[model samples]
Target: MADGPTINTIAERAGVSIASVSRVLNGLPTRQETVRKVMAAADELGYVRNAVARSLKSRRTHQVAFAMADVGNPAYLAMLREIQPVLKAAGYRLVLHSTDAVAADEIDVLHSLGERYVDGLIMSPLRVTEAHLRMLATARAPVVIIGSVPEGTRVDNVRADSRTGVRLAVDHLYALGRRRIAMINGPLDTVPGAARGAAYREALHDLGLPYDESLVQIGDFYRPEGARAVAALLDRVPDVDALMCANDLIALGALDVLRAAGKRVPEDVAVVGMDDTDLAAASWPSLTSVSLGSAERGKAAAELLLERLRGDAGEPRVVTVPPRLAVRASTAGPDYDRRQSGYDGEGGGK
Candidate 1:
């Protein structure tokens, strides 16, 4: 194979020294005439800058790392899609790291900061721990968190208002005359699970509905776990008219269980989930869900990291993305009966 064009050839064509070409390619300060010459030469030679050498010289790889709890989750994939475009627009590449919701793996990424492999990091840890806090306290590069950190922590954070998301689901269920509402939620230790559980209780109190311990079941944030939780929930509260799940995966499990038990969706029981993931739409009776703004939150976290990389400000920022209720076929069945009662619609009225 023929050898590719070199910096020397580019410099000769541009009538400038190799050093000037290097400066321009590395985005370092250079004279205007030199920059113009380098660009013209690069265009003529069809030369691409050697990223490896440039990274070595400047100590910046022009890449950002994104560490997530669950790479397989559609919500996380949605966030990745949003984050990739924004980072690409800013002339940076992405490095994805799936931590499997493991604290050790997350901390490993943070420690990798000293290697200077990436300019910044955006992490979404499922659970915050002391080790996570310690890593953030002295992180080598700019770090933006997509989940909740400590209240007074000095870091940029973008969080979904999951509390509001849960409330939206509960309130929607109540409006549908679902007084016997049961919750099949994830474990209470995780950030989202804890926040959503608290919001469920608060929303019931606000709606003047009694909080029944018998109607709640805890599961891990997986389909099988959700199915088991629903099984337990139904065994105890057979009259439950509505089910609120902490996430789409759990809701899907609940749907499977309900169907297996010969129950009709929305007619016998209305089901709602959080996150508004693609699975919610693809289910047999498409699930109504609360949007936690996962994609928007990812974009915000990326923007915050970019701003820090550009040295825009010194203060830590907190961004909260609002949640919205997405109504679909699962919660739009005939049992609601509002349309027959002169309620003026099949859709849930505001």
Candidate 2:
């Protein structure tokens, strides 16, 4: 049997020297016309480079992996949308992994780095476990973490100042005269959940509001869990005037439950959410939310990984993307009723 196409085959078909084909394929500087001829011939001959052979010689797979809690989460999707373009422009392909925010799955991804299937990885783990720190300390390839990590960890870190993000939402709610504010939060074990819950308390304290244990309901970071938590909160504290949700998905659930219970948003109860994802703006009342800079964090993480892949041996860096509040109709707009009267009635948009 004949061997598959190689640099020699490409050169013979393009009427170029083997050295020229190698230069072109290796992405070394070459004449534009020569590169065009070699690439066209390779394409015509259905030539696909042997990635294993190339990696053995160059120690680079030219592929990057991005591991996140959930691929379908809009916040992570925002990051992926930014991470892909940046990596592609730098001559790399992306591989995605969903860890379900599980520590064991994340550790396995970190361990997979030793196999060298990818050049580097960008991971957004919800909980940074002790095993995570150990893996990050001696990872085989470059890693950029997209969430809070322990101080002085030797990896490029990108963080959303969600502590400040929660503060912004709470401050906005307080400014709107929401005194009996309740929090709809995710599990307290995760990094974001813990940080946001503490921030909520701090923000309330600063506003001269007491921290009421009954005002906080813990749930998972999903729409259904959010609905359950909100329903329970409503049942317990019927007079609660404001809700500071952990993320946009949960806030959406709050909207669903509030609408079901015949509550007028921003009138009977205002809702504020974190992670200002697209759903925040697309919901019936257009939820007000805190922008934790998911896209910016993704872009920054990719750039940092690229720098490491380029042989940058400098000190590990940390980038904290600032947070901003996106105010929409859910919290304070006069035209919400007119714009979304279709979903204003009981059990609407559920």
Candidate 3:
């Protein structure tokens, strides 16, 4: 293996630039044609990634790993989009892990720190458990958490204001003369789920609106389950005037069901969603949503992790990104004209 082919060799054989060869080797985005050509060349040369040797010689692999709950969720995708570029610019290759929102899987990722396969890690665990804290306390490498951890966790942390984000969306609905507003939320056991659900009730109380137990439905964070939850809510609360979805995906599902049910958005029922992802602008009538600064949080997390890698001897830092409201056509004011302000739904501005 000492005489193994180098990236330049693969580039020459593949008839591509060294950078292209590196990109393909690192699993970065590339055209299928380029990928195929590079793969064939590597196969013919019997070349493999030399991460082990690189780590041994440098004592710092110049590699980083990001572990999160779901790959398909736009919020996490937004984070990855931001995290990837920062690490890339800092000369760190990134490895990704999708832990399926499972605490055990997340704990396993934290424990894998001992292997030193990479220089550092960025993890966004769905639920923080005692096992997670135990692992963090003894982790061999620096770590950055993209979600909230308890006080005194002694790790760099980046958090979004979910409680305030949910409040922003609920207040928007209430200001629009929306009474009898219903909430379609995710599992209340998770961090974001519990925080948003409790914030919704608190917002209602502040508005003097009665908190109706019949107005809330719980489901997973994906589209299909969100659609079903909306369907059930529609059946139970036919006269519901507004909907507050926990995230953009669920709001998208609510929009689908509302359109199919002959309910005019912002007229029959105003809708608001959290996590102002790109899907919000792409949806019909556009979606009004709360922005928890996913991109900002990701960038901040990368910066913090890299700071530790650079031998920062400071105390652990905590960064809490502020939230904003993105008001689109979903909650268009009474005077808003769809014919005049029509959108193509191309850029939701996540």
Predicted structure 2: clash tally: 0
What lDDT score is found at residue 64 in candidate 1? 89
Give the count of colliding residue pairs in each prediction: 0, 0, 0
Positional deviation of residue 262's Cα in model 1 after best superposition, in angstroms: 0.5
Best by lDDT: 2
Question: Which ranges of candidate 3 are over 4 A from the true structure?
Answer: 1-58, 333-350
Over 311-343, each residue of candidate 2 has an lDDT whose tens digit, in order, gives 999999999999999998999864664445555
- Give RMSD to native, each candidate: 9.6, 9.0, 7.8
Judging by lDDT, tell me the better candidate of 2 and 3.
2
Candidate 1 lDDT (Cα, 0 to 1): 0.85
**Weakest 10 consecutive residues of candidate 2 by summed lDDT:** 48-57
What would you estimate as the lDDT of candidate 2? 0.89
| Cα lDDT tens digits for candidate 1, 44-149 | 7766345423444465667888999889989999899999999999998898999989999999999867545578999999899999999999998999999888
RMSD of 3: 7.8
Give me the displacement of residue 269 in model 1, in angstroms.
1.1
> What lDDT tens digits, residue by residue, belong to model 3 across residues 28-68?
55554675677668767875335423333346557798998
The lowest-lDDT stretch of 10 consecutive residues in candidate 3 is 48-57
